[model samples]
Target: MKYINKKIIFTFLLVLLMNGCLGIIPNKDSVTRKDTTTNIESSIYKKYNRHTDTTYYSHNNLFGKNISIYWTKKKKEKSYARIKFSYLGSRWIFFNEVTLVNAAGSRISFHIKSTDISTNVVSDRIVSEKANFLLSKVDIISLKKLFNSPSVDLRLSGKSHKDYALSESEIKSLFEILSYNP
Candidate 1:
């Protein structure tokens, strides 16, 4: 009888020790360490993906409207264009700019220097040599109007051209979508 009691007691103690080691009871104060290095690395990679090769713009009081835009190379032989209405100046004139991206991963930027209604100037210049075109006088006004219009489209010109043109409305819509998803 004594042997039977000892055997039962030994089994109970073993079960109890196994349950404790297995965390059957929640340890509220236990310092459970997690290896977050992988998660941190993934998050860092995701940040770059989030803003990869994209241009962003916001309200420019000079343009009298709010706008956003984005563009990327559409094909090996083609470039991308984006335009956005930044703001309307005090004179109720719209301000905006156009951004171009070529298949070679270059950005071409242009903006309005002056408008008929206001002296407020909105200007943009390519920060990199990857951009291979210059903004002409007519191109500036045309780009601004494009963004001002309700519809958006891209029209490419020039032989061996790296220049791209976009309207204001199109730019804004693209940025709006990007901002929403981001």
Candidate 2:
């Protein structure tokens, strides 16, 4: 009887110790990770994914509108900038032309290679449309050169044309986004 009690106690103690060790060890899934990367002076936000080895940079609320600029690059892929313009009207504006005018009055134009359109119906009478344009490598180089200036103006043209003068904040964010080597 004593032997049985001792065996039971010993088993209980062993199990408790094992559980204690498990509780002390941190779990891989439970470990908290920082979602956003460190901030730079330009307020450009970046997020990195360890699994895919990619980095994404984005800036929101550009041009006094809800426009957003995004840049992403994978480990072995070329980086590209995607500019999304939000239009409040219902008409479709398939923007295919992009022009950047620097503060020095020099202009660089780019024919958009990739374009996407998405529309959202807010109400029975109101609809919102978003158009996305991808900038090419040469356009990016021109943007890098124009980054030295104080501001840059952007123009998008399709069936119609719209002009946007980039604010100083927008220019700063673009400078940082274009300044990266990779």
Candidate 3:
């Protein structure tokens, strides 16, 4: 009975190893970060699971004084890109829309899915708002077009609006952040 039990345990471990359920082996995905010359910072990293044949992409961007952004997608989720915008402010702005303007004066719009607000009590009271945005395939294509433009500007709107024109360095960082592929 002891010999049979040991054989069963060995078989289970071998099966787990073969199926990558053991989680002991290192993954082969390479993560790359681009050098930024400007105050704006951005990076994209990919994590690939060989056993399940799935790729996960992580994109992070930090803009000016108060806005930070992260975009992510899994390989199987072809139609949607999940993006979160974290804004630090005194009160909720309730951002609902984002517009991208290329150098040619053309504009593309993305509708934000939702916004959530919270307050933090620190040395100074500050309100933090997180806006969730979902980009469809069409929006992604429009973003690609903006990436090729000489300059880009971002306009975010809700109860209030904020506009930012990308500097050369910021534009370069945004380009690099969006260029990553699985």
For candidate 3, lDDT tens digit of each residue in 43-143?
45556677766665554333322322235545566423544444444455677776778889889776765634333431133445555556666755666
For each candidate in the order shown, give its overall lDDT on alpha carbons. 0.32, 0.59, 0.52
Candidate 1 wrongly placed segments (more than 4 Å) = 1-131, 155-170, 173-182
Best candidate according to lDDT:
2
Candidate 2: what lDDT?
A: 0.59
Using TM-score as the measure, the top candidate is 2
- The TM-score of predicted model 1 comes to 0.19
* Distance from true location, Cα of 83 in model 3, Å: 3.3
**Candidate 2: worst 10 consecutive residues by lDDT?**
27-36
What TM-score number comes out for model 3?
0.53
Per-model TM-score, in order, reads: 0.19, 0.55, 0.53
Off by over 4 Å in 2: 1-42, 48-53, 60-68, 75-86, 113-137
Comparing 1 with 2 on TM-score, the higher-scoring candidate is 2
